[model samples]
Target: MSTTQIASPRVALVTGGSGGIGRAVAERLGAEGMAVAVHYAGNRNRAQETADAITAAGGRSVPVTADVSDEGAVTAMFDRVQETFGGIDVVVNTAGIMLLAPLAELDLDDFDRMHRTNVRGTFTVSQQAARRVRPGGAIINFSSTVVKLTLPTYAAYAATKGAVDAMTMILAKEMRGRDVTVNAIAPGPTATPLFLEGKPQQAVESLKNMAPLERLGEPVDIAEAVAFLAGPARWVNGQVLYINGGVA
Candidate 1:
């Protein structure tokens, strides 16, 4: 690219940026000239690795640890933004946990874990973005197609994302007249660590074939959807964009 074509950078915060779709979103946003705040729940090494990759790509990023579900931790995480990037422009709430158990078999503790991270954590990060980000900034939350599929064992996990989708619409309306946008992305089946857990290789293969596209989504696929929502897709607001490869 010519020097004259260089774009000015912006600030982006991606919770759970250490792994999975969060990492892809951070890297993609970084490539788009957004300085990244890579928030991790506990994995400093992975978060730093993500930040290092961004730096190697000629984009700026910083790794910061926060629970995302904890109000104080979430607040402190934003405080670092004040020091590192002055103010934030885009906030992506990708920090989520998926605990699969049939509704009758679900444990309360597992339910809390999913709710605390997927639902409450999203709320914490989104509320922070709502309060602090600039006029054209955004709040993007992660949902899952499991909410639509109603997959048997995913009862608790799906419940949380269902709530996220509902809250996203309400929050978008709550923003009322602000130039900023709020939206959610419900990815179908992505090839990510979380998606692979406990499944045999054959099962994974079969899952991939379940999509009409005949392949599981890459993390980058979802990240690209997120990039559009966070940056260029201006008219798309208060909607849940499902990147499911037409699985329905």
Candidate 2:
């Protein structure tokens, strides 16, 4: 990892920094002068690519692989972070899985997968952050606007994000005197591979135009918001900021 004379660079661990929103979040954190730990569950190649870009541009990053659902793995991931970067000052939980199906038709496998990552994984990472992150550090969690929309076929996914929103508020209070902040970002229809997979071109365009902004969100759009939450958003805690382009 690289260092500067002005201040010791802060280390950030971004879970799911392999692709899509996670990639942009890691890059944005790097640009903000934070040494990042780009954590991925299985996609080391993509994680390394993100880390390499940061290091190449004079910032520093390390790619750590761990399944957040596994308590042992999450612990190991944090251990590695401390070993490599001295300590973690921020943790962003971006690793989530979405399973969309009506309540009745929902497969138990899909339900378990989504809950395991979106809910349990969030808790696992947040616990580590609570225990490991230094005072004045930040924890940023991802929620989704679908929770607000209460959309069909997103029952289980919405429930998980609901859990996230609740956790953010509670965790913020738990860190009351510690100078730490916890917040959840609920984004609308972002143009990530996970969301844009296999849609017809016309249907994609229609969905794009559904938002008041008239286009699907770019990764930079969400990244900019995340950067603020991780840096300048000190007073904003225990709140769910919706970056949905005015979509309900």
Backbone atom clashes (below 3 Å) for every candidate? 0, 0
lDDT of each: 0.89, 0.89
Off by over 4 Å in 2: 1-7
* Ten residues in sequence with the least summed lDDT for candidate 2: 1-10
**Candidate 2 lDDT, 56-163, residue by residue in tens:** 988999999988999999999999999998998889999998867789999999999998999999999999899888766789999999898887888989999999
Candidate 2's displacement at residue 99, Å, is 1.7
How much does candidate 1 score in TM-score? 0.95
Quote the lDDT for 155 in model 1: 85
Error of 2 at 66 (Å): 0.7
Runs in model 1 with CA error above 4 Å? 1-8
RMSDs, each prediction?
3.6, 3.4
